[model samples]
Target: MSQSPGILMMVIAFVLALGPLVFLHELGHYLAGRWFGVKAEVFSVGFGREIGGFTDKRGTRWKFGMLPLGGYVRFAGDMNPGSQPDPNWLALPAAERARTFQAKPLWQRAIIVAAGPIANFLVAIVILGAFAAAYGTITIPPVAGPIKAGTPAATAGLREGDRILSIGGREFDNFNDMAAFTSMRAGMRVEIDYVRDGQQARTETVIGQDVSKDRFGNEVRRGVLGIAAPAEIVRSTVPVWQAPIVGVERTFSLVGMMVDGLGQLIAGRVPVSELGGPMRIAKMSGESLSLGFESFVVFVALISINLGFINLLPVPMLDGGHLLFYAIEGVRRRPVEPQVMEWAFRGGLVAILALMVLVTFNDLGAFGVWRNLAGLIG
Candidate 1:
């Protein structure tokens, strides 16, 4: 087993991986707000007290905060980092009020709020595309190479040389797609379609699962089909012109996986202990860094996608929450009542804080902090 990276390395890796992504996310919001004539009062990476900063020519105070978890852009007329509207800003003269975020048209406000997450998605796409362009894409046919006896695939009547057509109604483009899909569906029964000797057939089997730990000692649980990849592999160099298209397709594929994972979590098919916070991210970042530069860059891209997807969740205090509010206002042709919005935001904040605590606790447990403490006490 490989040893985990030291604590200092983990912290440095976390900062390196998260800092630029957070900055880009906020930059997306700031640029969009400025485009609509909104004056950005502050552009800070992270939260809480300002550690170091300077005012830009546009009067935007660019700063770093004490906490290095996430970032925000406070536009004019915003009461706080959450972008709540300030009633006091309403008293501003016409010229100044016009430059406030809240004073912008409803559509513009929605765009500004959405830009942050969109930026993260774009970053993932660009990175993935660049990788494809550089090293090309490798694909394997979704044909069973060897079926281990008594495994899910074997039990499902699958045989060697059988070509997989689909699983759980999703068509397979490559063996990797099939493997990735099955890996996340552990213990769930799903329909599998394949062709044997030019004849199509279908069967259902419960996906087998394996639980193990990575080199860093983090637990990993994955569904196993007990069918190996075919011997033949194909690699194709992606054209520079088509890289972006490949990027978009790959990005959406990842988003789909995220949706599937979230659904599993909600359905209780997966343990809530799988939820991770900053500590898990830091560990993964350090481990990826130790592997090599390419692995580290890919890890960053994956995190970028996660950041984008999570922000789009309809939970309050997220970019998605703001979009939800804007959607309601659009239909009603009026903003949600201030008191109602306030209460909703408060509730959202509480929910967010609770989730953070839960994930942090899970992280500590995964790291053996609780176990070590118990050993010492005993």
Candidate 2:
């Protein structure tokens, strides 16, 4: 069926977003592998035959391909570009097989597989740091700024200095996230968990209109409980001694959150619709950029971390899949049967492809493509 301009924009935006993200992710693998004396034979930005490329000094043929969906790094002795070991590699001299991935120490192998996602997280941190250094940080503490005496919040017993803990079941880390939530809807009643006098607290708030005329000469309506945040960050940055600590902690926490989110998704507590494909990400980045360069960079960083986390999930035909085999070998003292592993990998490819289709459509619907198409048709 024919679509609308909005739908087309979303598609274009999505491809643009995914292209770089996928390329960088695979680049991480390529660089890290090469650094460790592992030979990367090919570095492809996308799948299928090479559309454009040049050979590097180490015989690594770097190329761009027709498909922008995915990419791979082909290591020496690999069965394919993804670093899977070849039978011929095993048949070679013991010294030769020693250079293959299957011959590497489990620790080294894990590091190589992990480097891809690690690169993503690193990208996020650098982007965030650069943005933070440039634009400074924003701080919105939970302490209520002020509630107009005649407003519903004041009348409803909401008071200033009340520390917000959670809203709509999501824990509020700071006032910034709270503000983001509040800005989404107007006149929505919400149960807010908070702290009163540094003790346990609970609140039910009926959001009222915080009326204002927006910059576009239009009345912009948004949810407001008449809360205000202090406009400052104190310029928080990792000290030289603490950079790694803070970065690692943040990375760990993000991983935990991603895992928790996945668990919730699998349990049906959170819908798969919450998942964002390239289209959603691009739209988000564009919006964030409109807000500020810092916001755009930070959003990209966050997306990079998300990309890293998802790729590392223990699914067959993924880096995690190879790690899984190594893990099994460590425990059982033998590699998984080649035939079984091959079949499992085939299934994995199928699963991954199916998921891509679902997410793409989800992205279209998310951007309201169908509605726009309907409007066009009408």
Candidate 3:
């Protein structure tokens, strides 16, 4: 079966956006494996049945697959495609066993596994840094603008021209910093330090929650302080030398946001409905592409950071799971038993599959698939 033009375009765009990131992530594992004297048997750009491939002189088979979702690298002595250690790795010829991933030193194996996530972060930093250097950034002072009547800002005595100095001990030079901080603390009371007419003062206010919808009609709830930015705006051209620094700062800031959101979710403060999956990501990818190259690049950079951070999670069947095993080995002075590793990976696979189902259901709802179906049936 063939897809319609619109569907095809979405598929292509999704691949273009994700393919490079996946390739780089897998390449990190391959290159690190080679560096540490482990032999890579296969390098794939997707999963399932192979579409096309060629063997290199070093005997690595590089191939593409039908599924465009993600890719993986298979090292020698991998028990299965998922890279579990083979029980027979010890029985192989000494020369061949020496080249197997399981035979490598603990540090080498850990590096090989960690290299994937590290590459993702590096790619995001480079893309964001390049854009920052080329296009610069916009800035507005943290001075208070007109407070919305009957809102939290007005209730807390925030007045026009009051310059925001800090929130929760974090100082800011731009309104964005304060806004970012405030928006994340919905329903939480915090001390806001500011200067009104050159007199230092502090006000405690609980951030108000407002529910709004995006262009796609997805509901979003955010903390609204009922404060607006000053009328004046500033645009500054960042030097190439400083762009990377700015990129690093921006990357860390985004990571912090993710951490905060995860913490909120775990604490039962945030609803699970806000979580999105592949369909939501595809819809977002198309929307971002329509917004132009800069917006799309920024979106990609953000996703890349997320990819890096998520892979570092200590879940089985992920890079972080492998690292966890290595950590245990380091502490216990021996490798985790192959049977235990197998069961862990199996459990991880089940957990991952369940998560996928949940997120996909959420995506369908977010995309209004059920609503549209109901409308048609009605």
Candidate 4:
């Protein structure tokens, strides 16, 4: 695994992470619509050419599409792909109109629209917490666990149970501190300090630069000891039991950060080009796969939360956008004029498409294609 090619890793991670999350997201909307007595016509994991499909007892054609990027759920009267409604269908008998999305109670409509992203967040929280509870966290205290026999650390006479006092002569306490130092000084020479057999010892070695791509498909250089994670997993009866709570807290913390970052991007303090689209996300999924299944699962959950949060934003053309219209209708006790709604929807549609383009450009930059293109042009 240490010698695995970086490119191959990026490819696998992208699919594993995004594919399931998307399907689950669509499922949320599908289930909610059903709950509200709105039947689904089609449930697809992607758009366009059909890879595979089946008609369920309910007559819903469930299938996987060719693109494998984005997905959608088509409701019974969703003549429009967006599932808002068709006015011509609404012009039919009152009973027919009742089945339409717009005709449903405002609360039900809101739930159906909000369901997609909500599922994403729930999946993330459960997956992360369950994983932590299942696999007791590893406490990589400064103590030596196992050093690869042929690695530099092993050759330097380091032994099991030796407590690492410092690396690169800088005092370090836990794995986090060591990681911080190693990252800042990857591929550089350093001296390791450890207490072995109750005696302090120092060994000189150079940290290896791991030329790897992160889950996001961005090239990252990190310090490596050419060692594998140890088998000494700590089972914290008390701490492990609280994994769910901690996991939710952690997820919320991340959400807060993303919200802050998006706020900055909107404020123009952060570059819109820094926003990543699906391309970058898939690439990242591939990279995360290389780290290990645990790490990959954690990332998958995070992406789910991100999907949930992103969809909740009150922007048109999105699930949240429909909810916005519903809110406006509720406030005024009537639907906004069709012409006015169309204009606003179009404006929002343009904004979303523009943002998509910007993010795709960022994804290209993240994958280093932008740099390659720049070099070629020059």
Candidate 5:
């Protein structure tokens, strides 16, 4: 295995990669709020105590916080960074109320909230489009090469030159998609459909497992199909004008995969240990940086898509949570009772915190932090 990047390099890479993405996310909210004539009280990158900032002419205090995990934009009449309306919003002077976020129409509020995620998606599209324009899109045929004896594929009567059609009902456009689908399903039984010599066949087999160690000595496990097929490289030069279209298509494709992965996790088919947090991201960022500029850029685009997708989940204390409330208000033709909103936000906060703790614990285990500490103690 290759050596891991230095600790300092990992920290630097984490900051360099996540900082701009967070800023852009918050900027989307800020710009949309401003467009709706809502006054932004604070535009902050990161969380917790402010490190340094300056008040802009529009009274938006642009600041960096001590914790670099995430960020937010607090608009006028917001009770907190979560964008909850102030309880006393109606009591504000007429002029002040007009410039407050709560005073905006429901549709405008929804747009402002949704803009953050949309911005993230746009970032992914632009980066991917640039790559497609420069290097073209690549695709590989989903054909089995060599089936290892005694493995699941071999046991299921799979043979070389079989064209894979789908696994577990999910059709694949290419071999990469098939590989991705299998990699997350270690130890899970899956039905495979394929065409062999112009005849269709189906087989059920458990995905095989491969366990190894990264440079950091952390155990890595992945599902394999026991096929030793080298990916047939097929590159198509995308016209510069059509690059964005390719990017958009690929972006949606990735989102679909993510949805499937999420469903798998929820159904208990994928282990919770597979989930990760900031530390995992930092590790991957450093590793990608070590690989090359192109690898790092791709990593950034993937993370951007993740950030967008996650923020759109209808959980409280997030942009999606806010949008959810706006949606409710739109249907009801009035805001939800303040008490109900408060409890919902509280529940959302608890959920978000719990997720953070869970993913962080998973990260610690993945990095062998707990095991190393036990070694020191023992």
Candidate 6:
């Protein structure tokens, strides 16, 4: 673990890391809306009271806000910034209806809703592709070095020198991929395929959870297979033409890891306290910056993927929520009632707020705020 920077440095690092990614996400929605002939009322990089902005010729107001933690693109006829439909949209004259989001066909609407996450993925892929083209990747054979007694690997009959071939049918070309896959699957059963000497074998094992303190003293739960990688590592560089393909592979690997972690959290295998909010992100941003540019870029990619995935959750007040509603609309042959949308969005808002509070409390604890207060009382 590295020492976090000064408060000011951390703030700067957080803004630098999060702001652009948010802007890019909103940009995706804005562009898609424009392409589909839907009018955007505002393109904002944050929430709350507006700080500054200018309306474009197309009547889109581009602005910044006091809070830099999140952003949105308010399409025309949206009730608020959440993309909720406005009744006034339906009452508008026929000409005005042409540019409203609600007037668009279902498929076009789905595309606009999905574009934000797609943009984040695109950014990750491009950054990763650039890295691959520049430095290639360090490859390590997925050979087991040591097996800890009484652990999942030992119980599953894994031994030293067993070459890990795959997990859940996905083959690994590097130890790093295997490690990430295993770590994200705490308390989940996974099928492992490995080769020993002249024979290949398969085994089903329940991944074990290992609890450890993170750099900021927060309890972190990760899956452990109880096997270590061999000492040797190899750097394998691919041709420039292959960089993008390799980048896609790397991105998908991360996506799987995120999905597994979320599943573990939902299944109660990982505690909800493990959820980190803005302060944790800020600290990580500063620490990653200290590690050098390449590490920072990698961190950005992870966060980007996370942002994309989070938005796709089927909770209201998020893009995914809207998509869920659209899915029902597709099946029902009509929009969900506005009253239903309102209730769903309200519930989602409450859930999002509750999560924010939990993570913020965890962040304060991680930053030693409670300790400082105790010292003051003493």
TM-score of each: 0.97, 0.74, 0.91, 0.70, 0.95, 0.89
lDDT of 6 by residue, 318-373 (tens): 89998999999999999898788878888999999998899999888777798899
Which order, best to worst by lDDT? 1, 5, 6, 3, 4, 2
lDDT of 2 by residue, 1-378 (tens): 322234454455556556777788888887767666777778888888789999978688989988776788877787852355786876888765665666777778778888888788887766655554454445567667677776555755767777778876778777766765665445667787767787867767676666565332223445677776744334565455455555555566666667756765686544566666656666665555555555555666677888888888778878788778779878988778877787878888899888888888877876668779999999
Q: List lDDT for all candidates, in order.
A: 0.91, 0.69, 0.85, 0.75, 0.89, 0.87
Candidate 3 lDDT over 225-306, as tens digits, reads 8988899898889999999898888888788878878887787667788788877778777767766778888888888888
Candidate 2 clash pair list: none
Residue 149 alpha-carbon offset, candidate 1, angstroms: 1.8
- Which residue pairs in candidate 6 collide? none
Candidate 4 wrong stretches, greater than 4 Å: 1-9, 91-97, 135-241
Model 2 residue 347 distance off true place after TM-score fit, in angstroms: 2.8
Task: List the candidate 2 regions with Cα displacement exceeding 4 Å.
Answer: 1-20, 80-84, 145-158, 165-173, 177-194, 197-257, 285-293, 372-378
Q: What shift in Å separates residue 267 of candidate 6 from its native position after superposition?
A: 1.4
Clash number for candidate 3: 0
Total backbone clashes of model 5? 0
Candidate 1, residues 1-378, lDDT tens digits: the string is 757988998998999999999999999999999889999999999889999999989999999999998989988899964577787888999999999998899999999999999999999999999999999999899999999998999889899999999998989979988998888788988999999999999999999998888777777898999999999899999999999999999999999989988988898877889999999899889999988899999999999999999999987789998999899999999988877777888899999899999999999997899999999999
- Which 10 residues in a row give candidate 3 its minimum summed lDDT? 1-10
Q: Which regions of candidate 3 fall more than 4 Å away from where they truly are?
A: 1-6, 81-83, 168-173, 374-378
Instruction: Tell me which of candidates 2 and 4 scores higher on lDDT.
Output: 4
**For residues 56-109, what per-residue lDDT tens digits would candidate 5 score against the true structure?**
898889999999989998889988645667889998999999999888888898
Candidate 2 global TM-score: 0.74
Comparing candidate 1 with candidate 5, which one achieves the higher lDDT? 1
- Which 10-residue window of candidate 6 scores lowest in summed lDDT? 213-222
